[model samples]
Target: MNLKIDIDKVQYDASKRSLAKVQLNSLWGKLALNRENYDEYAIVESNEELWGYLYDKSFEVKDLFCGTKKALVRYKTVKEYNSKISRGVNVVIAA
Candidate 1:
């Protein structure tokens, strides 16, 4: 597959080449993202929502940062509860 990043119309430009390389690397990094290492966050504004995540069996709560108006819950799905493959991840596409 041909992947190209358009750079400034200059011959042997170090800056332009560096920028293009960075762009390409970032693209690859995003495409090969590890969903298992990614954490899902939610801003809970109600007591009900906060308690829901705390008691949720489908998710493993990692951290809880509480604020006055809203709270942030950082969590990930329980492996046992979510054994299915993620929709955003595809081994063929990543390959």
Candidate 2:
């Protein structure tokens, strides 16, 4: 017995194709995301917490805006937060 499968000859409904495309794109986008390149925003309520992020060598403070009860910090990690941890953002294989 013999069987053949041709992916090029297969046909799919418009809705099915759209759904598959969206799912695949989302999967790849998540894999390609680099957390280090993105900045994080946090609402620091205490001077210790605010100063901790400001003085840390690993983090680069972008902006500081003070509010009534808290301060908003926009910062990005300049160095690896944890040397033993892996971000799992594999851009090479995903591309």
- Candidate 1, residue 87: Cα displacement in angstroms equals 6.2
| Candidate no. 1 TM-score | 0.63
lDDT of 1 by residue, 1-95 (tens): 99786676536979999999998777666677768877999999999999999998987899999999999999997786447766666556545
lDDT of 2 by residue, 1-95 (tens): 79998999988799999999999899888888877678999999999999999998977999999999899999987875455434778777578
Which pairs in model 1 have colliding backbones? none
The segments of candidate 2 whose C-alpha lies over 4 angstroms from its true place after superposition are 1-3, 6-9, 80-87
